[model samples]
Each structure stands twice: as C-alpha cells, then as structure tokens.
Target: MNVVTRSAGIFLLAMAAIALPGCRPASQPSGQIITLRLSGWQSNPNEKQRLDYLLRKFEKTHPTIQVKYETINSEYMDVIKTRLIGDVAPDVFYLDGFEAPLLMQYQVLEPLDRYITPEFNLADFEPSLLNAFRYRNQLYGLPKDFSTLALIYNKQALAAAGITHPPKTWAAFTVAARKLTVDRNGDGKIDQYGFGIAPELARQTFMIKAFGGQLVDQNGFATFAAPNSLRGLELIVNQYRRDRTAAQPTDVGATWGSEMLGQGKAAMVIEGPWSIPYFKETFPALEFGTAEVPAINGKPGTMAYTVAYVMNRKTRHKEAAWKLIAYLTGKEGMKAWADQGLALPARRSVLGELGYDKNTLYAPFVAGARYATIWQAGKHLPTIRMNFNNQFISALLGEQPLSDAMQRAQDTANREISWAN
Candidate 1:
C-alpha cells in the first residue's frame, strides 16, 4: 500500500484502540470519545466566554468528540511555530492572513478542500477572505471572520470644527484635519489633533497601492520604496510633520488609534468594525460616526484583515478535526459569533442576516470590504513589516527624509529575505 494508505490504516487502528463503539457516530467505527486540541489568542475576555458557550453547543451535537481550547496570550506565532516543529501543536489553530502564507508554504497545514462538501456551502464565504487562505490552488483554511478599515470620526468634534460631513477626498481630508486641530487653552500645545495615525506597514499598505505602487514584486521581494509608493506614503509623513495636524498614539499618551480617538485626543481615526463595540463598552457616551476612508489619488482604498481556522497537517484525528472546522465556520456558528459585533462575518449570508450592510454604524466598513486590500504580501511579510515600521517611524519623526528612510527599509528587508531563502 502507499504511504498515505498505510497512515490511514494506522490511524484507524489507533482509533479502534481508544474509541468505544457504542458512542461512536454512525459513519465512524464504534470507539471511545476523541479529544481534539485547539489554540488561539483571545482579543477580550468576552470573546473567550462566547467561544466557550459555542463549544458547549457544538459538544451537545457531536457527543463523540471533545475539544480542549487553549489561549496563547503573547508571541502567539512564535509559540505555535515551536509547537509545530516539535510535533506537539494543536490539532487546529487560528491563522491570520498575514501569517498564513508562511505556514502554507511550509506544508504544515492540511489542505481543507478534500473535506469541504456541497452541503457545507463553501461558496457562501467572501471570495477575498477565502483567497487569503488558499495556496497553490489548495484551500488550507476557512476564514472565520474579517474586518476592513473605515474612517471613524467623533460627531461632536466634527461639528465643533464646522465640518458637516466626513471628508470624501484626500485633499479635503487634509484641510478638515487642519481645521479640527486646536490649542484650546492657548497653552502652545494642541489639545485635540485632527487625526490619529498608526505608523505600521499593515495600515500604510493601502496607501502604497493608492498610487499604483506594489508592496512586493513577482519574486516576493520588497518594492515598497519605489517612487510611486513613496508618493502615497509622503502624504502621511507630510500630514504629521508639515501640516502638523496628525499625531501618532505616542504623541497623545494613547496605546492605539481607537484609544486616541476614544479619549478625545484626536477627532478621527482609521479603524475597523472591532472599534464599534469597543466604543460602546469603554466610551459609551462618546458619540461617533463611521464613513468610507477618503479617496486617495481619486481611488477608494482601505485595508482588510482576516483570520481563518486551519487544521494541522499532522493531526491524527482528521475526521474529528474536519468536523470541528466545518461546524465553527458554518453559517449558524458564524452568526452566533459575529452577533457580538466585534468583527464582521466572513459568510455573505451571515453578514446580510446580521444587517451590518444596512446599519448606518457599520455600513462604511461593509462598503469598504468590496475594494479593501487584503493585508498580506508574501511569506516574508513579517520581516518586511518590521523593517518598514522601524524606518517609517523615523521618517514620520523627521529624523530622515521619507525617501531615504523607505530605501533603507527596502534594502534591509530584501537582504533579510535573501538570507532566509
């Protein structure tokens, strides 16, 4: 027999040794219950509670299987990679689009196409989200959730500045930002800046593409330093340094863009749906509005982030793992999870059922989904991201010219990628 057949036979034997026939599902051999391991990071305590509740419901339906869920709070990717190399990784785990390419390329994830059934309605998922987890025509993951950036503005702040609506174009946005900036007490230091900025590759990537620039060339080497890309990036640097109307989180003693906006440190921020619930819970009285990100170079653009449930290739209980993946990513399950409004559902039906597209608070995010750039480049993205962020901040601080900073970053990232290859 072939290696695959032999492995299947051994897996059956192992199951037979542990499974109890009486409780086994109708299709599988009678055996004792199987326990599957799952790992992921929790964004908040409520998210963990919601997942635990869902897992309980899943268990009630599939009595023959049990899932042990674990949370990796820090350095999640590093920990997962170590566990994978040691052959002790969870049967299934969360995979971000940014990290999917590397694991998919390494052959560490199981191709999920074989397990997908017509009844599962794989076509219900958003094509862009699904494409993030595909590698070489094989589906390695099923996107569980996604989010796209939108311009989140404080209503009172906008009105105070005499702006009746959010800016629709880059030129207008800059003007609005300058108008909103104020030194309320004549203390020489601005009390409320017009915009809060995030100086990271993930947020700036869409800007790079706004002017027909690419993040990586055909060979997956860094190309973000090209002239066209710099033009878009220069807009951000100028807003912060020359216009002096934008501030990074550090400038306002905030940890992130959401916090910067929430505390009234800034009037606007580019964030995703996750900020909706955050504002309601943490800043309940803060009146806010959402709008599609301003057009750059006469083109609408924003960033989309997604995560998927991927099974480990070496999982011994392939059948059980597949069942769990299908259940979690299924329409019913997705709706339950997305009802929290923390993230957008990946399935078109679930998103529609949730009414996010029609809800004024969430419509901008939903609209941007149609054209947002998926936040992924290649397997070397982590390396490229680190180099870009380090130098990009230097440029934003005026320590170096934007062009020189980007050039240094590009050269350093490509050098590191070459060494790895």
Candidate 2:
C-alpha cells in the first residue's frame, strides 16, 4: 500500500480505541455516532433540495448515523481520482457506468456482494442496469437511477406537416423528418430543423449496434469500422449531409438538443426523461409529445445512461456507508427521489408505483428499458469514445465519408488503448 493508504488504515484502527465509553447510558445505542461522507454531482437546485430532504429522512431513521453530503460538478472524475489516491475520498460516491470499469480494474471499489442480503432484493433492479456495476462475478455498485433515450417531437409541427402520429419505423421517421424540415416565409433560410442531433458516441452507440455491429471485440479493441457498423451509421450521415433535414445543436447556436427544442429550432429530438422536467420548467408553452425510438432494421434499439453508488475500499465506516447506500437506493428512498420525474427509477417497484407505465408522456421511456443499450463497456471504452466522437462529427459535418471516419477512429482508438495498457 502507498503511504496515504497506509495512513488511512492506521487511522481506522486508531478510531476503534474510542469506540465505546464507560459513561454510556443503558438506553443509548452500542455503536459510536459516526458520520459517513457521500459524494455526487448535484442536479439542478430543486432536485438537489429534494435529495437533501430525502437524506434528512434517512438520518432521522438511523439516529446514530449522520450523512455528510458533498457535491462535485466540474471535472468530477479528475477530482475523484485525486481524492481516492490520497485516501481522502468519500466513503460512498456516484460512479457513472462508463467510468466504473476503470475503477473496478484498479480495485478501489468495495465489492458489494457480501454486503447485500436477501431482504435487499438485488433482483428488483433492472438486470441490464445492475450488470453495468458487476465485474468478474462481483457487484461493485448499486444504480441509483437511469435515463433511456426516446423520440421527443413537437405536436404542432407534426400536425402542420399533415402528419397525425409519430413515426413507428425508421423509414417512416425519415419521411416525417423530411416533411418537418420547414422553410417558412420563403426567406431562403431554414426555420426549423427536422431533428436535432448531439453526434456524440454516448448517443450513437446504439446505432452502431443496431445493424449487427459489435462496438468492441472480446479483447476490447474497437470494431466499429466493420462493414455492419458503417451500414447503420450511413443513415445518420446521409440524413445530415444528403437529405439536409437534420442538424446539430451548434448549427442553430444552441447548447444541446434540449436547448434546440426549447428554442423552437428543431421539430424533433432523441433525448431522455430529463427533457420532460426541462420542458416543463423552461418552455411550458411548447406543445410536445414522446414516443418509443423508431425501430432500426426491424430491431428495437435505444441508449440507456445510468449512474451507480459505490463504496470506497478505504472507508473506515464501512457499515455506516452501506446503511446510507442501502437507504438511498432502497425502495422507499427511490420512490421519494423518483417521484419528481427528473429521471426514471432503476428499481421496478419504484417505477411501477410512480405510475410512469400508465402515463403516456413517460410510458415510452419506461418501455425502452427492455431493449435499451447500456452506455458501458470495458476499461478501454473512454479511449474509444473520445476518438469516435471526434471522427464521427467529421462525417456528420460532411468533411469526411462515414466509412473513412470510422476507420480512422477505430485505428486511433486501438493504438491509444494499446499504449495505455
């Protein structure tokens, strides 16, 4: 162990000296009153307030335990890694699915298998989501919440284009997009784009998998340059370059897809559940509806983004940390947090109780969980993702052919991962 880790371990043993005092009352609890630190990126102000309220309830339920919550926003992973190396990291913290593999490989995370009990009901979580935190047959984290991509469209725009319903398949979606791309007032400038695209690998991974494309081989080298992968990606590039119907956020000077929609620059977008809360709060007057992602090559596909809570292996208050994690991801706490609709619950029971299955606005996202492609892979995924995003955007902008771009992306990613290993 390094000096920092050794010091932390020594401090943990030193803390045991003051575990119990002789002056303790008979009615008092046997264990020491401990404070467990939890770290995560905070959402918007309102959502952060809701989480604070929920944590307060947990503290009340377990009188002997106190939660010291901390929020890290900018460069989250960089700060977290520094803290971990210094042995000053929080006892529990949020880990994105895409980043989990690197941390797991370093063995910095506590394997949660032994901490989980039957009553905790590990099976209640969606298997696809839960599997993201598992490595080498050991569970390293519990997913707190998740969001899956779906088609969000403007109702009035579709009606103006003489379309009564959203597209159900890729072919029909293509037609709808063409019709929705509008040029009002004959200004020779487009008024609204057919679709707003992010053009990042985080959103395009499912498209790569839609046409029998494997993102990576068992050896974790990038396989996205394969013919099958280009076949699926060709549609996106063609739409953006040839059809002139689709546009990215920068084309309209918007920050993201949600901003493009809220500003009426795009008629449709493929986004996640967070869009609902955003639309309601920022553009309540805008009429919108959501539907399941259109099928690709007769196969249902979408992307799922998730974050999980994991324990630090160096934590001194292991039992207390587990108690906080268990409560935060547990049924009651999940229901309280997910009721706000900022994101969907990872737990089946919480989702059912929230009635998202019956609500039309939320139903499509709930249904997508069954076929959503989780945005996670091996430890080399970060390298692969960076190269793909850079090269794929070149294709989207008509600066390069899709096939050539992906070839360069795959080759570069493999070279970088090889150097990293």
Pick by TM-score: which candidate is best?
Answer: 1
Off by over 4 Å in 2: 1-31
* Lowest lDDT block of 10, candidate 1: 17-26
- TM-score for predicted model 1 compared with the true structure: 0.93
List lDDT for all candidates, in order: 0.90, 0.87
Q: What stretches of model 1 exceed 4 Å from their correct place? A: 1-31
Give one digit per residue, the lDDT tens place, for model 1 in 24-109.
22355676688999999999788999898888899899998999999998989878876775678899999999999877876778
Considering every candidate listed, which one attains the maximal lDDT?
A: 1
- Model 1 alpha-carbon miss at residue 146, Å: 0.4
lDDT of 1 at 296: 98
**Residue 326 displacement in candidate 2 (angstroms):** 0.6
* Tens-place lDDT digits, model 2, residues 289-393: 999999999999999989999998877777777888999899999999889887899999999989998989999999999999999879778779888999999
